[model samples]
Target chain A: MKSLARRLVLAVPLLWLLAFFVAPFAIVLKLSLSRAAMARPPYEPVFNLSDGFWGLVESARQFTFDSYSLLLSDWLYLDVYVSSLRIAGLATLIALLIGYPLALAMSRAPAHWRPILIVLAIAPFWTSFLVRVYAWIVILKDEGLLNHALLGMGLIAEPLRIFATEGAVLIGLVYAYLPFTVLPIFNALDKQDSALVEAAMDLGATKTSAFWSVTFPLSLPGLYAGALLMFIPAMGEFVIPDLLGGSNDLMIGRLLWAEFFSNRDWPMASAAAIVLLGLLLAPLLLFERAQSREADT
Target chain B: MPRIGASGFAALLLGFAFLYAPIGLLAIYSFNASKLVTVWGGFSTKWYWALLDNRLLLESLWVSLRVAFASASIATVLGSLAALVLARHGRFRGRTLFGAMIYAPLVMPEIVLGIALLLLFVALGLERGLLSIIIAHATLGMCFVAVLVHVRVKMLDRSLEDAAHDLGAGPFTVFFTITLPLIAPALLAGFLLAFTISLDDFVLASFLSGPGSTTLPMRVYAQVRLGVTPEVNAVSTLLLAFVGLVLLTGAAIAQRMRAV
Candidate 1:
């Protein structure tokens, strides 16, 4: 009975994930190898269980690499992939720069104030993400507040064309992801022994040198965690780019969206998704390792 | 703790300003009388009033709310169970795989999950609608719930549970009597987090929602795509307010529980 209860406990959530999470990936992989068709589901090689075992074998034989080959051959796909990487990379770096200082300050805050500071740091994240991104639209437009402020200050003669540009997308990505980076970094920095920094300073290292040699090095784990958190999702970010980016320079996320929704090409979208997942595998693995290490320590 | 230097303090202020300015601007502008989002007009509640009468927006909001509540409830249950598996069930078979599956969704791109689930539904001949969306969201949210609840579970005093068992309490009885109340705050936090995630989601809803199932985010995205409008601003402001209230309450509860 005890063994049965243990099995029951594990089986419930595990079965749910297997059915909903893992099974979907298997379906996507199979779909990516199938052809696009004008059917209700819009993909070929559909296995009809009613047709029995022979039909299943026949359908399996119909799988093709056409979708993947198309993706590889097209310069559009290649360009979007590269640009997505570049944009996600640049955004992660920018977020790190902005997040690091804030996290450091937050960690250095009075003990009584740390919880409030932490809440403040993460408060924006709990708000509607779309609303926050939409806020940028109102600010970055030609007749927007940002231009108005700049124009009022005589900073620029004309309204800067920031909206629907790569710059705007970068801003949105960094803004949306900043909290993710900050929390991990703050946790890392806050948990470290302050005595080490004091020891470095007592040994005659200047504050800046001591920070670089001791504090920063100690925060590497957090840095990696934060970067992975930011980079992985930013790479596949659709809403930010679709809303803020130019029509011509599509990210892979936007491209995949168009493939599935606008073009109704399930196979193509699945192929793009497969590639995107492949790209994220290394970082995801690193994150898992980092998480387990953190758990251990 | 070390003192935050002047420059670090300045950076903190600026960073927060950057983080908050957009949403703050949206809330402030929601009352702008003029349709032009940037232009300052006399303050009015016209947009808020307009939101009340807009049937499409109202319908979507209802759909979103129902979806959020249902999915969050389901996620909370499954996720709590998963948390127990991770924190209480020591070194179960396939534990590494279980851990990976739970964490993967947290970091995986939304678009990937959206499309993957969409395809799965299509393959299984399931209609895309509220039911589909709830399942997709629950799948996504359960991981977050598990992660959140796992923290509280790890911090639990095992001796209390052992004592309950020693005094002739069954596993279920001990779980219900001792463990459930102890982890209630984290469970509440997880539920709220899941609900917020479902409410704020667009990508999954976009792919999974069929006719008459448009979510508020989907509606807002469609509008925002066209251009900015005061009505969208009004809806966004309301959402921001609702989410902020929920989170602040959650934070307060968490803090209170920690103090105990």
Candidate 2:
């Protein structure tokens, strides 16, 4: 009776995760292999399995790889993949550039101000993300604050087309993900041994050289972590792109959303999503390897 | 980088401005005497007053509060259990898979989870609304809370529990009376962490929320789409205050627990 009750307690969580967490992914996977019957009320998922023994690949289950082929053949999906990569890439670079210096300063600063600055760094996120993004909309509108201030100062005669553009989207994405970049880097930098920097400097290395040789390597764990943190989400982010990207900009997140919602192609949407999930997890696995290597060293 | 040097001070000031200006502008406009957020006429709280009576917005806030509270509590219990189990039973055939699954929600694209759940619910003939939102929020929140509680439980001297068991206590007694009290601080931290995330979630809520179940963020999203009013600022300010209080209470509890 005791063991049975204990098993019941443990089984509750396992069952919960199985039902809600794993079920959704399984549903997606199943939906991907099947076809979408858009004609029905509340579109039914169709998996034809008429062919005995050959049904898995060809006979049934809409065995034609048409959706995958269609998704792959489209130039737009490729564009989305490329654009997501490029935007996430640039955002990661900028975050590193900006975050590195701030983190370095925070690490080296007098201990009194460290916690305050750290809180300040993260406070922006506490405000609703949607609201923050909307604030950007307010700031970057054609006849908005930036232009109003510029026009008042006569910096330009006309309002700038800052909103609903590529630049605006990138700015929003970067702003939102910057803290993720900073926290890890700060943790890494703060824990770095100062003696290493002093030792390099005593050997006549310039401050910059000393930093590159000693401080930077010591903080690689955090650097890699921060980059991975930013890059992973940035690569797949739809919220920022949806809110800020111009009509022409077709990032994969938005593209995937349209596939699932607008196009009603369950198979194609699942294929794209699975591809995305795979792409993200692959790099994460590499990060895990890197972590193990660092531990070994 | 060192003292109150000019360049260092200037850079620091610039960073502060970069962080605050956009948000400060929003707060200011929330009380802006004019319709356009960018336009400054005078100071007024008309928008704040307006939000006081909006039935839809109030209902959404109530729904969000219910979800956040319930999900956070549920996540705490499950996560604490998962933490205890994982820390004790460190390796199994699917340990890495479980770890990955836990971490997945923390970093997975919100859109992916959102649509995935939507499809699952539709297929299962599960209705979309508050219940689905609670389940989804709890899933993500549970992952983070589990990681936290596990670390604390693992770091603890397992001997303490062994000692209790040796002294005639059962495993259940050792867990409840000995283990649980020691890790209470961490449980509090994890719960607060989960609560904040549940409160702030928008994308998942957006997908799962039905006509009567729109959450606070969802409402703010729609309102902002119409146009950001001081009402949003008021709502946001209220949320910020709640976070501040939760964080303060959590820190206080943690410190007291540590002292004990």
Candidate 3:
């Protein structure tokens, strides 16, 4: 009876994940191999169980890799993938540059004030993400706050156009994801013993040198975690680019959305999504490995 | 500890300013009397009043609240159960696979998850609506709850449970009388986090929702794309105020519980 109870506890959530989580990916895979059509449901069915086992064998034989081949042969698709990676990578780098010092400062704050600093860091996150991105539009548009302020200060005669550009998208991405970068790095830096840094200084290393040699290396795991957190979502970001990017900006997420919603090409969109997931799988697996290793230690 | 250098202090100030300035601008503009969001005609409460009469926006807000509540509650139960299994059942078969499944959704791009679930709904002949949105959000939210609850469960002292077990208590009884009380705060935190994520989600909710089930984020996104208006500013300000209140209340409750 005890064993049965234990089994039941495990089975319930495992089955829930299988039904909702794992099965969806399988469906995406199957849909990606099918042919697009104009009919309702929009893709040729991948399996036909009506004719029994032989029917299944026959259907399996009819699966095509044409969609994937199209992705390779078309330069636009490849370009879109590369551009997505570049934008996401740049945004992650910028976020790290801005986030690291702030996190380091927060970690080194006086003990009594640390919680308040952490709360302030996280408070902005509770606001709606769309609203935050919208806030940027208010500030960056042609007649916006930044331009108005610059004109008033005689910084520039012309209204500097920053909206609907790659720069705008970068700012939106960095602003939206900054907290994700800060929290992990703070966790890592905060947990480190201050004695290690003191010891390095005791050995006659300057503050900067001790930080580089002792503190920075120890905080690598947090940096990596923060980068991955920022990069993965930024790669597949649709809202940021759609709202902030120019009409020609063709990131994979926007391309996928266009293919699915506007063109109504389920097979093509699924193919692109599968490829995007494949590109992300490496870093994700590395993250999972690191996490389990941490747990073990 | 060493005091922060002047440069370090400046960096911290700049970072906080960068984070808070845009949000502050939004809040300030919400009260502007001008229809043009950027122009400051004067302060007024007209936009707040306008939000009350906007039927579509109000309806979408109601739908988002329902979905957030339903998904967060369900995710909490499933996630807490998964946490228990991971914490107590040390060497179970398929444990690694289970752990992987729980954590995978955390890093999976929302766009991919959105598309994958949309396809799943279509394949199953399920109509896309509130039910579909709830299912998708719950699946996504549960991973976060699992991560949060798992840490709390691991940090719990095992001796208390062992003592209860030795004193004529069954597993279920010990779980209810001891374990449940101990992990309640973590559970509440997990639920609030899940609710916030679900409420704020636009991508997943957009893909899964059909016809009348549009969420507030979806509505806000559609409007924001066309142009910014003071009405959006007012709605956003109200949302910010609501979320801030909930967060403060949650923190206060947690502090009081800890003190006791």
The candidates score, on chain A by TM-score, as follows 0.96, 0.89, 0.95
Instruction: Give per-residue CA lDDT, model 1, range B1-260, as digits (tens).
Output: 44877987898789889988788888999999988888888899999998888999999999999999999999999999999899988886789899889988988889999988988888888889999999999998899999999999999999999999999999889989999989999999999999999999999999999998999999999999989889889999999999989988887997887687
Query: What's each prediction's clash count?
Result: 0, 2, 0
Candidate 3 iRMSD in angstroms: 1.3
TM-score of predicted structure 1: 0.97
Cand. 1: chain B TM-score: 0.95
Whole-model lDDT per candidate? 0.92, 0.79, 0.90
What's the true lDDT of residue A165 in model 3?
92
Cα lDDT tens digits for candidate 1, A1-297: 877988888899999999999999999999999999998778898989988999899999999999999999899899999999999999999999999999999999778988988889888888889988999999999899899889999999999999999999999999998999999999999999999999999999999999999999999999999998899989989999999888976899999999988999999999999999999899888987898899899
Best by lDDT: 1
lDDT tens per residue, model 3, B1-260: 65677877887899999999999999999999998877788999999999889999999999999999999999999999899898889987888889889988887878889999999888888899999999999998888888889999999999999999999899889989999988888888888888988998999999999999999999999998888888988988888887777777877887887676
In model 1, the runs with Cα more than 4 Å from the true position are B251-260
DockQ of each: 0.79, 0.50, 0.75
Instruction: List TM-scores for all candidates, in order.
Output: 0.97, 0.92, 0.97
What range of 10 consecutive residues in model 3 chain B has the weakest lDDT sum? Answer: B1-10
Writing each residue's lDDT as its tens digit, candidate 2 over B1-260 gives 35335544555566667767887777777778787666788998777788878999888889999999989998998888777667766576776776666767778788888878887787666788889999888888888899999889879998888888889998778878998899999999889888888888888998788878989888887776666556776676666667778888888989998898
